[model samples]
Target: MIQVAFYDIAEESLFDFAVIIAIKEGKWILCRHKDRRTWEFPGGHRDPGEWIEDTARRELYEETGAEHYTLQPVCAYSYLRQGEKASFGMLYYAQVDELGPLPAFEIEEVKLYDKFPEKKDFWTYPDIQPFLLRKVSGLGIK
Candidate 1:
């Protein structure tokens, strides 16, 4: 399990995190773990002393069997969750040259969609939708 810590301080510490918005064959790739069963980008918490870009690269490889991609920072934002003041997120647009066979481990399924899914029950982070829309609209990353 991922562990988060809190401390009383004059300034807030952002919980550094990164995600890979991988696109392949004119489609976007998303995944869902059997435990969470929520659709999310391939990513995870950043390791201590790890560069943000490195975190994104490593998480993408670990979560999905994807390689040969490029990272472009799209957006950054902060929000509150579960009554905790947490801050952090870096969404990177990843263009992959190849889509390899993904192994089923923590991820139950890897789905590629031409258009974003319209399921209301799907687990998607709030900020991600807007970020994606902005990218698609050619407004550039915020």
Candidate 2:
């Protein structure tokens, strides 16, 4: 089973990885990975020497074709499993300003949702997505 805990952190934190919980005009942004038929936020492992927020930004643009937007750190989370080393990732909230055409690279397609989509992968729909949505709403987003 996957387990995670979240803690608020500075945007400039040195966390090595992250995922963006991006929204534009009141809709959440989700991506379909080329390798999996699953939808997830635009985020991943960070490049060496990259700041936590930059990782969120890079991943957002790379996955969603989001050029202009307001990105903020919601918190950092730790993923823990019974027999594995704990890993850290930052959760970011972005109000996308401009979204260019999605690049046909790692991500196959991008979708915007008013409410969380029910038909999604377990790790995303029930796990990652709801957690991110609560984090965003808890911060005052409707």
| Shift in Å, residue 101, candidate 1 | 3.8
Q: Which candidate number has the best TM-score?
A: 2
Worst 10 residues of 1 by lDDT: 3-12
lDDT of 2: 0.79
lDDT of 1 by residue, 26-64 (tens): 777788887875687787788888877788888787777
lDDT of 2 by residue, 1-142 (tens): 6687887663444466888888888788889888877778889889888877778888999999999999877788877777998778888888998999997679998998887645655344465557766777888874
TM per prediction: 0.74, 0.87
Clashes of each: 0, 0
> Every model's Cα RMSD, please?
6.3, 2.3
Q: RMSD of model 2, in Å?
A: 2.3
lDDT scores in order: 0.66, 0.79
